[model samples]
Target: MCISNPNSISDQTDLVAMKARLWALLRKEEHEWLQKSRLKWFKEGDINMKFFHLTASSRAKRNQISKLKEIPVKRLSVGSRRLLERLFSEEEVWNMSCRLCLIEDSSFNNSFISLIPKIDEAVSPEDYRPLSLVGSLNKIVSRVMARRMASCLKEVVGENQFAFIVGKQIVDCVLIANEVIDDLSKKKKKL
Candidate 1:
């Protein structure tokens, strides 16, 4: 007579449910191998808090172990001087967008001052004013150009890159445009 393990069916079902839940939870932020390895580790009872903490620390020390492999090629550096330089080049490429928008130098200056208020306050007024203007205008122009560049970029880099660029550009443009619009509205109110 052959005897079946009484717990086998229930164990399998529980495992499936646990895997589904983990996958659902980490779907947005997990790479394929990380997901698979995590599920396997979990089945082996290696993902409890103490074990997980140790694993995470060990993983962090390793050079090639990435939880999310789909991270962008370019690091998103905020307020870097190199970022400013890239913005400058982006603006030059989007000269047509600037021409179409008719954004003035003075308005650009004011916008830049408002955009990076922390940075502006740190610098002397004379030095800050010109730098702020150029930075702000470049940002605005880059944004406008980004929209036009999206289709071309999408063709080359695929949808994700295009989406990322367009999303950032839209946010930047909307912020500047809203500020300008609000000022105009206030002026009209005074008049």
Candidate 2:
């Protein structure tokens, strides 16, 4: 129905206001649903309104704290705090670092062996390959040692040795051998 009087202007304004309120309520509802979905670990792009409502209600029920108990608080004294600070001083930490040795202990040097299937269907033991997963401490220690050794590698290693040296590959020896062979074949020279 069309209002043809002065009330038409006021009716248009009221309609705009109602539209804005409706949009605001819709946005608020969407935001609440999104939060509930996240709490239930639901991913986007899925239309699961029933699941979202169920999870939201279940979460609301679970989150309600029924107990009302007063917990006793324990405060540490100044002298005890000072003693703890003294016990964990920089000097004590340095001493501990210097004494950090786990070479003799097999427990600390323990590594896990994981069997990975070599074929699609591994029926026999030979079909599976064993991979050693070393401890993080061992990897860190070895990497540190390797980095330290790498700095002095060039000075210690000779020019003829190509493998394990920086910017040199074992294939370089094969190339050099091939060149020598080609030169000998062309000139018919003695070794």
Candidate 3:
């Protein structure tokens, strides 16, 4: 009763076109959903969405397969080195305070030199947070003290030898060792 239609090529082409249109619509919807999901995820935390997306797909993986791929790098200069040193020293002093509290009250002589690297590792980039106003002020004071100490070192020794001394690196030490005594004295008004 039914005969085979040899002119079914047009009908097959229509079906293929419909399928392609449906696939495009579905892909658009999926992309919108992904963008919304990524926005929500980033809003929940400090996750960098761009980094997440770049590392999410296989296409990105293939692009990164080459060793010559562009990689961002920041070279640390003398100022940055000094800042890092000060941060490390301050963290060390804080940890040492904790150890001192555990031992004798107000004790400064503790055998805890090895704890510096541990503290540094614990306070990684992910754990870093913005400093408060008071903390920033304290850091400024420390830096000024460090600069003064370096100047004093240069006077005692020579400029060439003291040139290697990081201003921020010696700030805490200078402040604690009474090198900033005159500066503090000037701050105290007679009652």
Evaluated against the true structure, the overall lDDT of model 1 is 0.59
Best first by TM-score, ranked:
2, 1, 3
Per-residue lDDT of model 3, residues 1-108, tens digit only: 222563688776777788899999999999999999878777753467676566567567786746576865445556645644554456545554454343344432
lDDT, residue 42, candidate 3: 76
Kindly report which residue stretches of model 1 are placed more than 4 angstroms away from their true locations once superposed: 1-136, 157-191
TM-scores of the candidates in the order shown: 0.22, 0.39, 0.21
Q: Please list the C-alpha lDDT of all candidates, in the order they appear.
A: 0.59, 0.70, 0.55
Model 1, 88-125: lDDT tens digits are: 45555567545656545656534433333346346555
Candidate 2: segments with Cα more than 4 A from true spot: 1-111, 189-191
Shift in Å, residue 85, candidate 3? 41
* RMSD over all Cα atoms, model 2: 28.6
What is candidate 2's lDDT per residue for 1-191, written digit by digit as tens? 35466468888887788889999999999999999978666553246777768878899999999888996545545654444344334564444335554353556557899999999989999999999988645665555455445655655566778977978999999999999999989887553
In TM-score terms, candidate 3 sits at: 0.21
On a 0 to 100 scale, what is the lDDT of residue 187 in model 1? 100
Pairs that clash in candidate 1: none
